[model samples]
Target: MKKVLFAMALALAQTAWADGGMDILKSQCSSCHNLTGPAPQTLKELWARKGPDLFYAGNKYRKEWLVQWLQNPTRIRPAGEFYEDHIKPGEKHDEIDPATLKPHVSLSKDDAQAVADALMTLKPKSDLIAKEKIEEGTISKSMGEMVFDKFLGCMACHRIEPDYGGLSGPELYTAGDRLQPEYIASYIRSPQAWDPKIWMPNKHVSDMNIQKLVHYLEALSQENKNGK
Candidate 1:
């Protein structure tokens, strides 16, 4: 009876620790977050409160940054972009309110580690190819055009000298000239890590798509200079 009881206890304990992510989300975050893609706010068509998308949660954050932000919620944007002003502070751009943002349940160091690991594993839809820079002279002008206009969806968010998508976010017409190829690639892979309150959604394109986009962006750099 004693041995059987011990085994039962061990089984229960393991089950409890199985998915630290589910625990954290259910215990403290599920009220505002969704495990899958963007939160579904199917209520009032005009004014329903939906949470920030955590579909690409893993790609968007550094583990250290995630822990710090979780323990103490801070206002990454002073004016607010998508969500409510849960942790807004004065006129300051970034501020954390410890009292209001305290952990709902105590997270031991191990628990915190487990939670972070689970969160970081969620990536966008993608199959990437890690390769060296394509031959500068290898790409033709027509191929680059297709990449920018169609495959990568660059035209959706940014405008050229003529016109383009919404102006809610930063302009990227001159991206190629202004930014390095690798930096551009990294930014596409994870924009949220750069800023917690990013307005752009992670499109989660494949690695091949990412590389094509980078190459095209670099090509655009030359066009930008000549246009100016």
Candidate 2:
């Protein structure tokens, strides 16, 4: 009887949360994020987008990470989501004015939890991520770094280490800590599947190299945590 009552209570609580979360998303997030997609299909359409599409948030993010990030929002993209909008013509890469950057909207703990619940409901195609699995610590750090920087030329757009790499994409120094392993692998493998107009091109690397890249990111994130 006790177990039955507990289960019933949990169901009711979850339903209440789901409803509240949807309400919050509609009121607060719909303006910036596209909850429904067929992501942008052209460079012009992509540049017009104001934020990254969140239609795949359930597949892309960990629930705990989303909850915490919602409460204490930070910049993920080094350049704005559309680089053309943020980077000026003559300024050097490091010369971006921090003061000019717009901060993400933060939420209270309760609201953040509600919002995360809603975001977590936005799953993309399951098959797109099902095959990706990162066996932690399997790849040597040097090999993974080599694949990321030289073999793939990812460094041309993304920042892997502090004060290093380009600024057009998101900083990857904390990617292992911030992103799901499946998301990292899946996104790298076929970015177009997630966002047709996203700037990240398909590299057609071997699956082994993809696994190495994920491991590398995890190792880098762990090192950063320990160093701090």
Best by lDDT: 2
* 1-228 per-residue lDDT for model 2 (tens digits): 999999999999988897898898888888888888878888887888888888888888888888998899877777666665676655544445455579998999998898888888888766787978777557677887788888889999887777677778888888887888998998898888888867778999788888888888888888877884
Clashes of each: 2, 0
The per-model lDDT (C-alpha) reads 0.54, 0.82
Candidate 1 per-residue C-alpha lDDT over 1-228 given as tens digits, one digit per residue, 9 for 90 to 100: 999999999877655654765577667765555667643434242124334455556654556756655555443322223323333544844342444432234355666666666676775523321322433433555786677666666655455433343233334555664444544666677665433345456778666767777676666556766775
Q: What is the TM-score of each candidate against the true structure?
A: 0.39, 0.91
Residue pair clashes in candidate 1: 128-207, 177-221
Give the range where candidate 2 is weakest over 10 consecutive residues by summed lDDT: 89-98
Task: Judging by TM-score against the true structure, name the best candidate.
Answer: 2
- Candidate 1 has a TM-score of 0.39
Residue 111's C-alpha lDDT in candidate 2? Answer: 88
